[model samples]
Target: MSPVLQIALALGSVVGLMGFMAGVRHLAGTWQIGSEVQRKLVHIGTGIYALTLPWLFPDRWPVYLLVGLTLIVMLLLRLPNSRLGATLHSVERQSYGDFLLAISVGVCLFLAGDQLYLYVLPIAVLTLADAAAALAGSTYGTKFFRVEEGEKSLEGSAVFFTVTLLISVICLMLMTSFAPPNIIVLSLMVAGFGTLVEAASWRGFDNLFLPVGLLIFLSAHGTSTLGELVFLAAIFALSIVAFKIVAPKFGLNAHAVRVYVTSIFLLLAVTDPQNTIFPILVLVAHIWRRSVAPCDSKFPDLDVVAALVLVSLGFLTLGKATGPTAISFYGIAAMGMLMGFCAIAASASRPVVRYPMVLALALALFAIREGVVRLNPDSANWNGPMWPAVFICVALTALGPMILSRVFATHRVVKLTFLALLIPLPYYVISTGF
Candidate 1:
């Protein structure tokens, strides 16, 4: 048999396994609780498949076949009848729309020919950062850190940043063979950015933005030289300390701005040709923070400090290995701020009416942005077919949220939306062509 054929068979097996796990989770009542056990099982299973499939089947055909099968399974899962077949499918009907959105973004990134580290970073941010925040907020969050209309706690953000940092470092080590000396700094910076963006405005779309943002940084700088990298690390560390010291007197928003400014200067100094992205990101963040207007209450500032620390670390790590471009960095920063604002708005809204409208608006924005990018040949990647795939994704993303909101008004559609977002993730894994 041809190598491609063998590879195709292996991928088929992976798809089958994913389907089986999804079905089993649906059967176990634990899916409703957002059960960690179930989530871990699915993640572990998917990870194993991702790691072993290529070696098991050494050809492109198997990969393609696996992709086809995975899509089929996802489509089937979307069907009401299919869901019912899996343990009567009694999951809550929340705005699972975010999940679907996340999956779509992940697939788009993968198809864009992003690196392995780039591919895994966002997923790690979503899974680890989000989980840490929730767990810590619920368990250790004594004082609420209210920023504008958001409900994030200082403790929660701290946990989120810490977990995201660790996870990024681990992912970098395991996923990529290339480990520059300044990796520690790079991972910290990327994770910090990922967490801050996520904390400030994810609207649940962190899954999409975090990894893409990190990849932008990676693409810009390939990797830094040893001596220069060390200096960059020292600067980043000092910036974090300074931000922490002045945050209380200036306020969270002010602190965020200061950190933003410092990051820009550091990037300019370290990278050869200044990447415009960091400055643009700082500008956008400043604008967004101003737009939100600071809340009247005094909240604990630990989370803000932690987020700054982690982001600084991530940047340092990435800066050592590669330089970043202005366009990509700022674009990601803008998107992150937008997501954070949306998330806060959604949380503040009365789920019945306001949430749906927000979701619609987000979908619309995503569509318009995607459409503009697709139409403008100059804005897109010259080598790959990013436009068409992004166009399709935009349509599907818009349609899913709209339909769910309209039809499942009483049911919590958030979870379903989230699941739908994840639909494209498997395709990304297969298409990675690893």
Candidate 2:
């Protein structure tokens, strides 16, 4: 089919799906079905439709166009007065899952290209595994554990793992030529990784992370030995324990720690382990400084953990896509810059020393990055733009707090998150120079 015709069909199908889900939502209310179930119905339906992309539309542009249109419609539906908001927003939780879901579809499609299974597997995990976990948690959840700002059940997580494992097995079996033993090991790894991501995720961000993280993990580790898989899993387990034990000292909450540890582990998966050091140090420094700053009753301090996850994932994608050692440096620098901003924001009361502290922290992070590279025998050659990138990141980061403070003194999470989205702009410019 022609691209134009494909785009037209996609739009029609998406619109029809939206109308169908709206009707479903109405019937759900009539039947006294809970809002969460209603929302999951839409999620599952959307994800299942997404799975057909490789066959339905052969070209990437059509999928991109569909994603763009869907996002705009989803945003409009989110408005308080929109009648269709109930189809998705019926849950009381503050979530941007719908928005992220649209973006995840577009991103995974763009990345996967002709790799049908690559696209299918991640979307399957996101859709089926996530819905299963939520439903299981809400319905059969007996044993609960605290996560971020809420509680998740052990029962729910187990269900999630089971569902993910099954999905991974089926996908690998049909999609690739790997032996049964390797398939089982890869399936186990995928399930474990997906379950951790789902459990750690809050407010629908899992819609983005589950698919994106799984795609990256599978792409990087599809040929791994059982021993290698076990070793990585052991390190991941240790990281979680370490984060849980140390988060309190750094003034990081359970949620922040979850985001940080998961993101770092993802970084570790694709990049040299040494490349992750500065980012880890930045995570520690950012949270520790925020912890020490005076508390305010009127406005709660901003939680930059989600922002950290966003920035890290952005750079990871950049590094992976471009295949440049300098890209890794940029990731470290971007994170270091974020650490600087956290310092300035945490010291909002003491404005006098904020800039100096930010400068010092940025320099310290640069020094640490250099030190790590020097110590690693296997370090890739340093790029020329790296130091300049670090300087530019720090300068831009310092300006961010000032700009936000001028508009509003209180640090709202959304405001900082939007700011974090801009953190990569400098590196994008610098990479052009390189």
Highest lDDT scorer: 2
- List the lowest-lDDT window of 10 residues for candidate 2: 293-302
What TM-score would you give candidate 2 relative to the actual structure? 0.86
| Residue 388 error, candidate 2, Å | 3.7
* Global lDDT of each candidate: 0.47, 0.72
Which digits, one per residue and each the tens of the lDDT, describe model 1 over residues 147-233? 434556778878878887887778777776646555676676766666565554423334343444455555554366556655655
lDDT, candidate 2, 301-385, per-residue tens:
2245566556666655555465554444545454544554465555564567866766676677667767765765543544443
Q: Tell me each candidate's TM-score.
A: 0.46, 0.86
Q: Give one clash count per candidate, in the order shown.
A: 56, 0
Q: What is the lDDT of residue 395 in candidate 2?
A: 59
| Cα distance off (Å), candidate 1, residue 328 | 13
